[model samples]
Target chain A: GAGVSQSPSNKVTEKGKDVELRCDPISGHTALYWYRQRLGQGLEFLIYFQGNSAPDKSGLPSDRFSAERTGESVSTLTIQRTQQEDSAVYLCASSLAATVVRSSYNEQFFGPGTRLTVL
Target chain B: GIQVEQSPPDLILQEGANSTLRCNFSDSVNNLQWFHQNPWGQLINLFYIPSGTKQNGRLSATTVATERYSLLYISSSQTTDSGVYFCAVDQETSGSRLTFGEGTQLTVNP
Candidate 1:
């Protein structure tokens, strides 16, 4: 089975530019999540999408950051007017949703992640 | 919002040594997971032990939900085990969201 996949493994953009990172979740995964990791720091939750329900945007740092998931498959995180602070690795993960809970939580699998550098 | 804390922010061990990593959460959680981020920055699920205990090869984890803590144990470690170990929890308030700890950076030398 293919794991989660992210595009633009590495990206370098000038400040004030717009960048979009794409994520293709595992087939049949109903839950998708985006996270950001700064150098030497832990990952921060950015957004989450489940099935056809409304997405959770509480973790978005600011208005410039937004994410969208079409159906239950692909998701894109767009950062408008990229800033130097946005330079980090954007990781995507997916799970089988809450329906199948072998344990108390849905185990999430991650992608290679996209490293964004804003100059 | 829940707070997660991992002990021994950094650790160094010789190959074949045993080590224990601990995670403490500020609130009760229904989902507790342990992840190992490899050198390539890919997060590999180590355990989904929200409670009780689970063992896989040389790794094992135990989560005491009532105590709000979890422990990950690695025995006879190898150089390939060098990476960051993170503990994440999904508390009742967060409802399906996971709060991650700063993580423990482990370096295993052969």
Candidate 2:
């Protein structure tokens, strides 16, 4: 089975530029999540989507960060006017379901991650 | 938000040895998982134990949700086992959002 996949394994952009990272979750997965991992640091929750419900944007660091998922398949995280502080590895993950009852047992499959560098 | 912490931020071990990694959380959680971030930057799911103990080959994990802690044990460590180990949890208040620990950087030398 195909695991979650992310595009632009490596991205280099100048400060103030905008970038979009893509994610392809495993087929049939109803939940998708985005996270950021700074060098030698832990994963920081960004946003999540479950089926067709409204996405969870509470974790978005600021207005410059936003993510969208269409039909529970592909997701894109966009960072507008990126700053050097935004440099990090963007990771995507997915689960079978994310309802309150089933979420406790869902195992998230992660993508290889996209390393974004802001110079 | 629940606070998660992993002890011994870094560890160095010799091949064929054994080691234990610990994770502690500040509150109750409905889900607890262990992951290994390989040298190539791929996150691999190792365990999905919210409670009880499970073993896979030389690796095993035990999560005591009641105590808000978990332990991962590796026996006969191999050079390929060198990587960052992370513990993440989904608190009752956070639905499926996983709060991750700083991770334990492990280095296994042959």
TM-score of each: 0.96, 0.96
DockQ of 2: 0.70
Interface RMSD of each: 2.3, 1.9
Off by over 4 Å in 1: A98-105
TM-score of chain A of each: 0.92, 0.93
Task: Report the C-alpha lDDT of model 1 over B35-90, residue by residue, as the tens digit.
Answer: 99999998999998888999999999998888989999999999999999999887
Candidate 2 chain B: worst 10 consecutive residues by lDDT? B89-98
TM-score of 1: 0.96
- Listed models, DockQ each: 0.62, 0.70
Looking at candidate 1 chain B, the ten consecutive residues that score lowest on lDDT are B89-98
**Candidate with the greatest lDDT versus the true structure:** 2
